[model samples]
Target: MVQLNLVKVLLLSNERTGDVRYEIFSKEGENPDYPEKIIVYREGNIGEHGERG
Candidate 1:
């Protein structure tokens, strides 16, 4: 039997807009399909600072 565990870390943060960024890492290189690290973004706003509808 084999087990896999993933770790997530906060890469970036924004206080004003409640935006966040995260990174996923495979410490043991468990999965061949994925690299050592993966990036993810969680946006609080629809557009960037200047862009608006």
Candidate 2:
């Protein structure tokens, strides 16, 4: 069986909104179709200072 885990981190800014960052860590062998590596996913407004949902 293959197991996958995900970690999410929130980055805040000085404005009014921030960006949602995601870090994906996997422990799998390097495969052509399923290559194991560190992936980063970011979205939303960056450099914002406020509460985020």
Candidate 3:
């Protein structure tokens, strides 16, 4: 698989209200099945009103 470059990973929120987004980052070569130790990052909480929380 190709290595992810951009830290931001756009995705539909579980709420499914609208275009909510987040960012994820992990160490290079880290396996999801056997991750020894990895770091993660998530950003923002936008509501229907389009405000950061």
Candidate 4:
């Protein structure tokens, strides 16, 4: 068995037409078969600034 520690997660964020998109990926060389670790989060009109959702 083997475990690859999540040393760091690179966050990529973008906002377009009031829509926010986020992508998460592990640092390079920290893990193999990285395509299996890609995560994407999406949201639309989450808030009106200074708000938490």
Candidate 5:
């Protein structure tokens, strides 16, 4: 026998505004096990005002 599970997630960005991101995850089997997952949607950058240093 096999089992499945579904997961949904939403992400939003304030810098751009009105922008959103979506993600979905699925697992198989009754006792599915996996390592942690990391998602980096944004990167650090100098603001329009310019860097202080």
Candidate 6:
């Protein structure tokens, strides 16, 4: 099994939509358990019924 080492991480935000996107830096490889990019919504960004923009 190959292990990914954390090199750096950045949290970028979209001013227009107020959405936060995170970038994870690691040794490039396939990791089924984790994802490379992730987007998180602000407090009012997501709807009550789990809607997204």
- Which candidate wins on lDDT? 1
Candidate 2 lDDT tens digits, 1-53:
87554433445443333354545445454333343445544454533453344
For each candidate, give its TM-score against the true structure. Answer: 0.37, 0.29, 0.27, 0.30, 0.27, 0.36
Check candidate 4 and list the clashing pairs. Answer: none
Q: lDDT per model, in order?
A: 0.59, 0.45, 0.47, 0.46, 0.44, 0.51
**Model 3 residue 53 CA deviation in Å:** 12
List RMSD in Å for every model shown.
6.6, 6.5, 6.9, 5.1, 7.9, 7.6
Candidate number that wins on lDDT, 1 or 6: 1
Ranking by lDDT: 1, 6, 3, 4, 2, 5
Q: In model 1, what are the clashing residue pairs, if there are any?
A: none
For all candidates, what are the clash counts?
0, 3, 0, 0, 0, 0
lDDT of 6 by residue, 2-29 (tens): 4555544555566445555444544457
Which 10-residue window in model 2 sums to the lowest lDDT?
7-16
* Residue 3 C-alpha lDDT in model 1: 40
Model 3 pairs whose backbones collide: none
lDDT of residue 50 for candidate 5:
42
Please identify model 1 stretches exceeding 4 Å from their true place.
Answer: 1-4, 16-18, 27-35, 47-53
**Per-residue lDDT for 48 in model 4?**
75
lDDT, candidate 1, equals 0.59
Candidate 2 wrong stretches, greater than 4 Å:
5-14, 31-49
lDDT of 1 by residue, 1-53 (tens): 44444566665656556556766766464763464667777665556664422
For 1-50, candidate 5 gives per-residue lDDT tens digits of 43445455567755533335555444564322441332334433356664
